[model samples]
Target: MALQIISVVLFTVFFSEALTLMCYNCNTTTECTQANCSSSCSSMTNHNGNNITFVKKCADSAWCFNSSINLGLIWMSSQCCSSNLCNNATVSENGLSCYTCNDKDCTNRLKCKGGEDHCITATGESLQNTVKGCASKNICDNITLLNNTLPQQHLSSSCCRGNLCNNAQKMTQGPVLLLVPILSLLFYILGLF
Candidate 1:
């Protein structure tokens, strides 16, 4: 009986589907749908003075800082969380910080989003300019060769730990703002109905 009970427990633990997380999956100005996954992510991108927010279900739990690529002039930052409908709540940007440079000089700074713990520097992607920003440790470790390569160009990248360690000529960190309490209050008020 003891062996039978142990087998049942092990089977349940290994085959449980309760670990799946519900996330809001949507792109810029698109319809939001529900998805089940291991992680939820909120990505914010800024391009040409415009900001767009995206939410999605993710397999990996990680985030990124102000990263720019040769595709366009933009910055992408993502926040990941693990809770039921947690992506609907505010994600804290209290992670690492890094400098982001697209085509212009590396003067702007981007705050690291959730789970982004490493700073990355990449250059030579046909554009022949350097881009520095924060990235998740997983991406840095598993995506070295392609760091400087994409479908259209060749690229090279290096990763490092430490805040603002991307080695920008002028190191500047983005402003850290807290909005948890306010969002909570807003939700509480709405729930009063």
Candidate 2:
């Protein structure tokens, strides 16, 4: 009975170890520590000019993919691997250039990296601030779909292809667009009188 119990315990330990994936986990400049999970390991990196930030952790394979956001002076990306302890830091090169905004100035150029293929211009909820950058088609599509479903859009965004296509002035509808219908109605009422 003693030998049988020992064999059972050993089998359980080996089986559990085989089922778990060990990954490196860390953030920014921190040293990586081993972490266990059932999914793949990921390494995410952000490059802002000369500065670089790196993160490593275990993540689901379904959510892992190479993606990037380019903000002229800054860029970010994420990568994933399935093998144990395979989350090595890696930086992807930007292939396209686009206009980006900083404060009120939208003249700066940004390199679009990873899977980004579109130039994006977005306005905040308050409409007082605008941001321009490079984004993946997935991000642009989801933003468009979400905006179309809202009765009153809290955020407005536009996406275009080719370099510097987003350089055009703010794309959000202004108060002037709202005044058109009101002005037309007033003209019809006055003409009737």
Candidate 3:
């Protein structure tokens, strides 16, 4: 009887762990349709990675930061949930709008240049050693700055963005289906004991 109970507990733990692990690695393709300016706007991928081929139309002399831009297609790894996990991801800089993961660090940090141009000060004086005119192009740039400047930085692009938010949805199907039967059997055996 005790052995049966132990088996049920073990099965429950194993099922939970497996489900958690699977969920960690699961990737869902969420469409940013609202950001799509035109009917032709569509995301595509190649051997490299995901790409946002469409470019947002720039209005007048004002350079459009492409706030509608797709930052990058991030695939959350199995270790994403843990504290020591490699949350380090990537972002696209070029028109392709993609990123690559070599190690754990995000390869492309500079996306749009933020429309800020840093030039040498005219004075060339020792007192004017510091570079100036380094300001953000968008409100989002301020958030990125905060992430870089702060110590305990928890800057997640998936957080604020609606619809595309990766909130770790529960697995309604897949191997979890197998776990259900196993769990039921374990419970039945426990009850018999």
Q: Which candidate should be chosen as best, given TM-score against the real structure?
A: 2
TM-score of 1: 0.52
Counted clashes in each candidate structure: 3, 0, 0
Candidate 1: residue 86 Cα off by (Å): 2.5
lDDT of each residue in 1-193, candidate 1, tens digit only: 9999999999898776677677777666788787777655443433333544454444365432222221123433344557766555544575667876634557567787655678776554354456676666544664543532253545556788887777766323221111112212222332210
Model 2 TM-score, all chains together? 0.62
Please give the range of 10 consecutive residues that has the lowest summed lDDT in model 2.
184-193
Report how far off residue 18 is in candidate 2 (Å): 7.2
Better of 2 and 3 by TM-score: 2
Error of 3 at 149 (Å): 20
Error of 3 at 36 (Å): 37
Off by over 4 Å in 2: 1-22, 45-54, 73-76, 145-153, 168-193
What order do you get sorting by TM-score, best first? 2, 1, 3
Quantify all predictions' global Cα lDDT against the true fold: 0.51, 0.66, 0.24
At residue 166, give the lDDT of candidate 1: 75
Q: For model 3, what is the alpha-carbon lDDT of residue 21?
A: 17
